[model samples]
Target chain A: MTKLLLKKLTKTFERRVIFKDINLEWNGPGLFGIAGPNGSGKSTLVKVVTGLISATAGEITIETDGKKLSPSTAIDYIGFASPYLTLYDEFTAKENLEFAVNIRGQQLDEAKMDQLLEHFSLLKRKNDFVKAYSSGMKQRLKIIFAFIHNPDMIILDEPTANLDAEGKQKVYDLVKQTAKEKMVIFATNEEEELAMCDEIIKILSYQPAGRN
Target chain B: MFRRALWLFNKDLTSELRTRYAINALAMFIIVTISVIMFAIGQETISAALAGGLLWVVIFFSAMSGLSRAFVSEEERGTSLLLQLVASPTVVLTGKLFYNLILVFAMNMVILVLYSALFDAFVLKNVYIFFFSFVLGNTGLAFASTIIASIIAKANSKGTLYPVLSFPILLPLLLMLVEITKRCSEGVKFEDIAPEFFALVSYNVVIAAVSYMLFDFIWKE
Candidate 1:
């Protein structure tokens, strides 16, 4: 179905080329991983894919029901999460989820939200402000908020960075379960996490010999 | 669109309710600044002539501190990216502007009371003109604050950069506000200040439209 496609994408910062003539595609439901070392533009690639930043030169297209979607319209179908992103600390988990739904013009069903909370083992802390929750709990809440609207494509950057063993398993299970209907793309350097991916793309940096 | 605005407004309101730091700082600053002004003009028979300019200076600096923190708080907590991903930039900016307008409006009222108490300023006989000046002035402040905050949100020294960037663009609005305020404080009729008031309104409208159009681009980074 080619949910997303990027053609000849290029980006530069302060006259330094990040990537040139980059092309990628996501055709269907599966887990895709982008692996690279620090400063390799993995995060920049994700940002361009999400349309958070425009490529210096390229076209990004999204397909839904055999129709091409514009960048602004495509945002509704994309759910994104990153380690640097956080939910409102003053908001309870439920309130945070409600806000996400409200912005998307959807009503929050109490029973459904409760089920999601229970799935993440956050039902007991549903009313607690996110600031009071542990880091792992906040991460779980972010995931729940991202998926609450049932987005067709989910992009996660360093999704498992701060999780313990149990938290990691829960996210892994969620990713696998979500892959049944939506494409999941994760960017990370951890080999263990790469084991769950259906495809892995490694990004390499170009270095001049003897320049180091 | 309005629902998204409401969500952001509620989010900020809840946060402010929990902290109360912006309001407390602004209120105390206003009180101290006004007290100093009173001492400087002691027994000089403070004229309604100077009341409008004095009141706005108090509100402007107070808003400078309070409104600049609006988006910085989001960035500090790392929630801004989440907000950008979930809501349209127009909605986000509108929500923040609306919240700041309410905060500044409250501060304006408090300043009015404190100005009267400290300097024995007379009651504003031209109530409509006074209200008009306050709304116009606050709109300009909110517009400038939101745009400047977006620019400096990525900078390392946002606290100092905010006012430096905003003051230049806001100068015209400040001048218009002072003229309208000066006329109203002198118990002049609304017709007498209509030209200045209209100019102030036009200034606010133009800036608000421009800022709204450019906000999505500015917030993209």
Candidate 2:
């Protein structure tokens, strides 16, 4: 099990305040959602949680079995998927997955890779370069990369963007199944995705509390 | 870490083979610059010192054209975020450094062969001195270039910043390379060039070590 804690989290860009004085914790075995409207710092919050971006103030700590994981090493245990994070366009689907697995320092689960590709209906196009993939197909591939490692923490930012009905259903199923024994955090404005979560943290409610 | 670096290096190599963005930039710049030099110095009997300086100038510009793409491509493609989340900064830097080193060496060899053939005065008296200086100079060049590429990848004015930032850092290294190559052209022995050889070695070591230490912050920031 993994536990994530955020204490007095605040993020400011220039003079604009995105979120302030936010405190939250999730000891997860279920889906947790961070819901906010467009440009309400949903992606920024997710980036901070994943340590891709630093917060202006506060600390984020990930602990497993009473051992704390530093932000520097948080990525090893986290899987992140977002529209802003693109795969290598010049590489085929399989090559991109190989690249990701290599960098993640994880064994290439050939069986699992094929299974996921088949599940996502992408097995036929696995040899084609990602540059040829449609937006929806690319989105599905991103989700596939995130889950390939079966990481301890799964973070999906705008998970269902550009997905068709069937593709959306496929992601929902995987999120449901994986969250059973891992940490899953979804950042989306879509109520449909939020409804799947065990709890929802609204960004608007995180307005500066007592200016601290 | 080495495995991951190799993976990154291979990824860049494969991509370069497919797109040829960096290679094209390097080849065009090298060919055009060398052609211009050959034309301007058609019948002049240039001294070995001048020839050596001219050779390093060609390498310096060629490196500038090619190495800037190391990190800029990732930022442009939006793959920077994915790489940041997946790989350690050291691994990324190592991969980029290796790629740049290969590129610099290959380009330098082309320039060396062409420069010697085109200019009769570009004779090397000591092959050993020239070879070691060439290798070490390229190593230092790649190390500094890779880190500077990473720093400028996040800047607003990427194209302008690359050469501007690289010029100051690479000036001293270029001077040493030019001096050692000049001695080689003058038929100086390896023992005679020891001071310059040691200076080149020290420069490469210092640049590599400092770049490795500073890259994490630049990469993460």
Candidate 3:
């Protein structure tokens, strides 16, 4: 099990305060949602939690099996998929997954990779270059990159932005199943996705007085 | 760390082989710069100092064109976040550093062979001094260039920003390399180039250490 805590977290860009004094304690074998209107600091919070961007103030703590992770090594235990993140287009789907796994200091298990590809219905195109994949396919591959490592937590930012209805279902199903064993956090504006969350973090509540 | 770094290096090599962006840019710049030099020098007999200085000038500008792609491509392709999410800042820097090392080394040796063959005046009597300078020079160049590439990758006007940022950072290394090359062409003994060799070593060591420390800040921001 994974336990995540955010204590008085704040983020600012230049003079604009993105979010202020946000705190949450989520211990999960379930899904958590971050819901806010456009530009409401949902993605900012996700970046902070994932350590992609540093928090302006306060602290974030992650623990798995009662062992606390230091800030530097915390990223290794979290899987993050973002709209702004992309795979190496020059590589095949399998090769891209291999690189992701290898870079994380683990060898790729071909059977697991093949299983994930099959589950995502990308098995036929497994050997094709990511650049040749459609937007939906690329998004699916991004999802695989996040899940292949089986991190303690999985964070998705705008997870369904490019997906069609069927692609959305595949991701939703995987997130639901994965949540039984790992922490799942979604930063999304979609009502369907929001409905699936066990707890919701609304960015507006953390907004500074005048900004909201 | 080394294993992860090697994964990144291998991934980059595969991507590079497919796209050929860096190799193409380096090759094109080297050929054009050397050809232009030949045309400008025509029948004139150039001095060893001029040839040595011109050699690194080509390399400096060529590096400005090619090595910037090391980090700039990741930023452009929006894969910087993927790397940050997967690897630590040090591993990312070391991976890109080694890739640039291979590239600059290969590019420098090619340019050296061609520069020596064409100039005639820049003949190296002490291959040992030239070899030491070549290894040290490429290491320092790659070290400095990789860090600068990460900085400029985040800037607004990336193209014009690279050389402007790189020239200042790389000036000390360039000056030392030029002098070493000049001495090598003049048939100077290895010991005679000790001060310069040691200077190159210091420049490389300092730059390598500073780059590792500073890269974490540059990369995460």
Give the top-scoring candidate (TM-score): 3
TM-scores across all candidates?
A: 0.93, 0.96, 0.97
Across residues B60-138, which tens digit of lDDT does each residue of candidate 1 receive? Answer: 7777777776788888777777877877788888888888888877888888777777766655777787786777787
* lDDT (C-alpha, whole model) for all candidates: 0.81, 0.89, 0.90
Q: What's the true lDDT of residue B151 in model 1?
A: 78
TM-score for candidate 1, residues paired by index:
0.93
- Which wins on DockQ, candidate 1 or candidate 2? 2
lDDT of 3 by residue, B1-221 (tens): 99899888998888899999899999999999999989999999988888889999989988988998899999998889888988999889989998999999999989988987888877777788888888988999999999999999988899899999888889999999889888887889877888888989999999999998898889898
Stretches of candidate 1 exceeding 4 Å from the true structure: A207-212
Arranged by DockQ with the best first, the candidates are: 3, 2, 1
lDDT of 2 at B210: 93
DockQ computed for model 2 against the true two-chain complex using alpha carbons: 0.77
Better of 1 and 2 by lDDT: 2
Candidate 3 Cα deviation (angstroms), residue B207: 0.3
* lDDT digits (tens) for residues B1-221 of candidate 2: 88888999999999999999899999999999999998999888898889889999999888889898989999988889888988888888989989999998898999999888888878888898788888999899989999899999999999889999999999999999988888888889878778888888999889999998998778876
